[model samples]
Target chain A: MCNTCGCNITPGNREFAYKPVNGKTAVSVLENLLARNDDQAEHNRQHFDKHRLLTVNLMSSPGAGKTALLEATIDALRDKYRIGVIEGDLETENDAVRIRARGVPAYQITTGSACHLDAHMVHDALHKFPLEGLDILFIENVGNLVCPASFDLGQHKNVTLLSVTEGDDKPAKYPVMFRAADIVLLTKSDLLPVLDDFDPERAELSLRNLGSRAPVIRLSARKSLNLGDWLDWLIGELVQKRGKLASDVLVQPVAEPQSISSNTGMQG
Target chain B: MHEFSVCQALIAQVEQIAISHGALKVQSVKLRIGPLSGMELPLLEHAYPFASAGTLAEGSILEIERAPLKVKCEACGLDSKVKPNLLTCRMCGSCKTRVVSGEELMLMSVELITT
Candidate 1:
């Protein structure tokens, strides 16, 4: 049998053996598998721009207090910001139900057996939402770090959460997620005193090493401690994004970069 | 696990490639997963069969090539492979670095079997 593709073997068939004809002829076509996802993400970006809504994609591992933090955040910003949430999960509508109970528009996207929320799922959920009055949209990505980082949800900002119990080395262990995030939130800080190896300083250093200069905020959702800072930061970001969008339409035409050199500049 | 999602995407890509190649089925999928990509090989392998069932890659084997994390350090100005945890420059111990390569998750090629 061929090891590369698991082709079946035949007796006295040297052609299908180690030197199979056309076996080495396999061409090297380098393509990013996330290309399709990226295309959909671009569409989602245009859609968000059309509606002038600020979107935030929240990511974290399971038990990282994503839902709890959102609950607290919604309560803090509900009076000021017209917030909407799209919750992604594998099985349950539990997070959506909790968010909706808080009197905000929340939709649940059950991916069936899938582990991440792609741009298509969020695009589908957009129809169910009233985009006219909403100022901010929160997409609670499926509880995973790896696959979700490969996908972009057309959000104005991507926020990654890590609980104190999950260890401070998460940024070191998962650099992709940390590098892609616009902000990193450390949740469940109340448990820090009870836990032994919960080093906030070391975690901050690790986050810095991951090439993320995003402001890292520590808060305990359960105790609602230091949550004001998180809420303030989110509101500030939303305001800044909204202001930029409005100014982009009114003040300046789209600026195209002129190539001064042969090399194309990297896109942020 | 998130590997199941990646497997799902892989299956879709393989099916598309097989159809375009006018093949009956995909024989194998060649993937390049980077070291800093944070993908667990064992979980991805375990989820492959489950995700590929009823698709064009129903019986296709997934072959993965692991790429090391290549970085350029600001202090040392040397490009080298570094461990995932210790991203600092090996020579100067400086943490200022930029990733030049090895953060890719790509499907390089697909082997299709024709009748």
Candidate 2:
């Protein structure tokens, strides 16, 4: 029987195509819906790799202290590494301006109605903001826990911030975001003394329940409490990336220049 | 909602496939979505028609298959299907389990018209 219309024809019957009512054919096209986005992410990754930039994507809800963390991190690492920031917001350049005030190169992407920062948007931002000579590029994604976790913006690491004000159940509530995180930052730790409802151990437990082994660090960017752990994590990632690149340069000395040039010169 | 954007992407991919295969219109689209895929199925279903309007997949049926969250236990060396909230191994009940399969949002196949 016809699936669409009540006719005496079954599916995969090519003979029925000649009939008036059964003209449809089923094509087995197995494809990924996120292929377009993932392709763009890979392209962005190549660009970052060519410049030897360690890119980290920060995701959180609004007022999660992502900007404040970036400000403190920039201040701490400015003397050591060249840092740049890509701030994503709905309608303002407020976050970008804050980063720039600290004497760092910052580019803001106002997503308009979009809730998350996609790879395509990040790719466009890369064109406007040069990635050269930057040790670290922080992509402070839109303050959304749900959407940002789904889209890959070609970042080497995903850092999720859960403010103490938001309760410890956030990790359990937003398991997808927590699972995607390489490291979870329990931000605004200074208020822990006053707030008796939130527990750091419970938050880490919820994250671990999601089958994620990502380490959780408690820090107050404003108070600079236990901020060294966050800084150490960033430095460790940078050192690991440099080690990988150094080994690549040694193993494929001839292939390194060709690949890097092709990636860098492709757009030009 | 981001579901609308995700639906738009899905419709665009389906339309492109239909056009590539010289299809007259899309009859049905099959998808395999997992619990951990970070997409609300109801919202995606609600946004489908609007996103697919005036496109090849306008009147297409969306056949969504829900996949089980599967994990592989490192300690037990066994793979088992588990709940989304608790991703531990079912047989061994180990916390050191790795996600083998679950977080997938794949377009499995499409049914289209030729004439």
Question: What's each prediction's TM-score?
Answer: 0.78, 0.91
Scored by TM-score, the top model is 2
Off by over 4 Å in 2: A1-22, A253-268
Judged by DockQ cut-offs, the docking class of candidate 1 is acceptable
**Model 2 per-residue lDDT tens digits across residues A18-134:** 333477767554566777798899999978888888999999999999999999999898999999999999999999999999999999999999999999999999999998778
lDDT of 1 by residue, A171-191 (tens): 888887888888888889999
lDDT of candidate 2 over B2-95, digit per residue (tens): 8898899899888876775567889999999888899999999999999999999998899999878899999899998888778877897777
**Candidate 2: deviation at residue A50, Å?**
0.5
- lDDT for position A213 in model 2: 88
Maximum-DockQ candidate: 2
Tens digit of per-residue lDDT, candidate 1, span B32-64: 988766578899889999999998889888899
